[model samples]
Target: METMRVIDKIRQLIPPLSPGYHKGQAGRVCVIGGSDEYTGAPYFSSFSALKLGADMAFVVCQPTAAVAIKSYTPGIN
Candidate 1:
């Protein structure tokens, strides 16, 4: 059995970006995980989504985790 090339698969999965696109229009993602001692997970997940061109990314977590996430980036709110 033959499989598609990695580049081809990537091209199919990720859409191309248009010029002058506004925020929250490309894609929106929400990561629901985090705790006082586990704040890193949501941070990484939200950041990865943003890096992938997601227009908006949010992380829902406990109050303590929320503070840590915000410390990492004000944009995560």
Candidate 2:
């Protein structure tokens, strides 16, 4: 199926997970977006990067959105 092919490609791109790797060795991601009306977008974007094996994720957003984004998770920068 098409989905299976996509999954296979993704697996090929991701390096093997290993304890020998240090932080930031996996990857780093930066998401830029957020506003008074749409704060969750950036938060989810950055969070998704982390969930997908990124070691660090940073978000750039308005001050108001920054507060909400930070509240969502301390794991993100």
Candidate 3:
């Protein structure tokens, strides 16, 4: 029940998608956490944002992590 309430609250906060809305008008998400030893978290964070209707997602990470994250998908910048 608590989860349902949280979901409802989030729903209320998100604007309804409209045909007239341009790309990125909905939302943009940036995830800033990654290291050579741990790149999955940041990649997942950015990917989740895109999956959840964000128009764009960016990941900031260590150079070594950047390559791994980039290999996951071209969707994230």
Candidate 4:
């Protein structure tokens, strides 16, 4: 694919920034997964959303995994 064309197509998919919009109006995402045997899955999903410009990322994981996830970053709530 033509790089510029791909870039333009992606840009077109993004909503225009407007003062009328409030926080999280552009994007909000949640990733829910994790367990004693899979503690990193939820964190990875939540982090991917944040890296992609989501206004908020939430991880809904088992209580046992919460501490590890929280310690990994302050970005996930």
Badly placed stretches (over 4 Å) of model 4 are 2-4, 18-20, 74-76
User: What is the RMSD of candidate 4?
Assistant: 2.3
In candidate 2, which residue pairs get closer than 3 Å at backbone N, Cα or C atoms, i.e. clash? none
Output the better candidate (1/2) by lDDT.
2
Q: With candidate 1 superimposed using the best TM-score fit, by how many Å does residue 71's alpha carbon deviate from the native? A: 0.3
Each candidate's lDDT (Cα)? 0.85, 0.87, 0.87, 0.80
Candidate 3 residue 70 C-alpha distance from true site, Å:
0.6
Candidate 3 scores a C-alpha RMSD against the true structure in Å of 1.8
* TM-score attained by model 4: 0.73
* Per-model RMSD to reference: 2.5, 1.6, 1.8, 2.3
lDDT of candidate 2 over 6-76, digit per residue (tens): 99998998899899988899999889999988988988888899888899888988888888889887654
Model 1 Cα lDDT, one tens digit per residue, 1-77: 13558768878888788888888878999999999999998899989998989988988899878888899876445
Q: Return the TM-score for each candidate structure.
A: 0.81, 0.85, 0.83, 0.73
lDDT of 4 by residue, 1-77 (tens): 69999999999998776878777886888788887778788888878877777777777888988888888876435
| Clash numbers, per candidate | 0, 0, 0, 0
Q: After superposition, how far is residue 22 of candidate 4 from its true place, in Å?
A: 2.7
Clashes of 2: 0
What lDDT tens digits, residue by residue, belong to model 3 across residues 1-77?
99999999999999998989888899998899998889899988888888899998888778988988898876545
At residue 62, give the lDDT of candidate 1.
Answer: 93
